[model samples]
Target: MQKFLSNKKLIFELFQFNQNFNFARNIYLNVFNKYQKESSIMKEQIKNFYLLLIILSLIALFLISCDNKNKTGTEGRTLSYYAGNWWGKASGETAEENILTINGDSSITLKIGDEIIIPSTSVTRVSDTNYIASYYNSTVNVSTKFTFNFSSDTQGKLIMEITQGSTSQSSTIDITKK
Candidate 1:
């Protein structure tokens, strides 16, 4: 009878230990599943953040390109638009018919009547629509400055300043592309 009682106590202790181990395993499994769910959610959030960052970066690049286009004045007209023959008449000091020719090579010529006042000279662009050409005539001791401002693709205004010794004269001419 004594031996049987000892065996019964040992069985009870084994049963209790088995139940505690199962409880511990169940707790561990629950915690591991919760951790897996939280880790997946965190990964998705990081992916979405990267996607949003890429989209915003693209928008910023597009805006910068548009701004650069406007700043360079390349929206409506270009330097090639000013390359053509223009005709007009001087309004001050001399009422002479003038022919201003602009070449594709950035060379310009100004003719008063049949005489070439400004021989083919290189033009300097001051702005999107403004240009300048200068000439010094050694025979007449005259220095001439021509400022050309284009109002449109076909029309422009020309201001010519001629300085001889201490005397200076300015003339305004309205020109049209031919």
Candidate 2:
């Protein structure tokens, strides 16, 4: 009877140990599965962030290249832009439809109504779009100075101020490229 009782107690202890081992294994498996799921989500987030960064970098590079190309288009400027025939109305007492010709060699001819005047002139560049044209007319024997303010390569405003024998006249002309 003592041997049987001792065997029964040993069997009960073994059964309890088995139950505890199974419970611990279940807890470990649950914790491990949760950790693995969280780690996978973190990896996906990091990958998405890197992809967005690469896309933004490419867009910035593209915009900078386009800006550089536009800057290169308007690089050099010369006096040749003023070498053309322009038709516009001049201001002041002689305000009428005028045909003006600016030659490549810096000569100027003006046709106001039926009268034509050829003025002796010299042009000096002030900046990329500004110039001073000094004119000496021997027929009227007067000196006139013109400020040529160009707004663009194809259009500009001209202001002409002349003094002749105690009389002063000024004219403003808006001209476009022919």
Q: Please give the range of 10 consecutive residues that has the lowest summed lDDT in model 2.
A: 112-121
Each candidate: how many clashes? 0, 0
lDDT of 1 by residue, 5-90 (tens): 88898888898999999999999999999999999999999999999999999999999887765555555443455878787875
For model 1, the stretches where C-alpha displacement exceeds 4 angstroms are: 6-10, 13-20, 23-27, 30-67, 71-80, 90-98, 114-122
| Model 1's TM-score against the true structure | 0.68
Candidate 2 residue lDDT tens string, 79-153 = 545778766666554543546777676556666544444433466768768877776767978888877788876
RMSD of 1: 4.5
The TM-score values for the models, in the order shown, are 0.68, 0.47
List lDDT for all candidates, in order: 0.78, 0.74
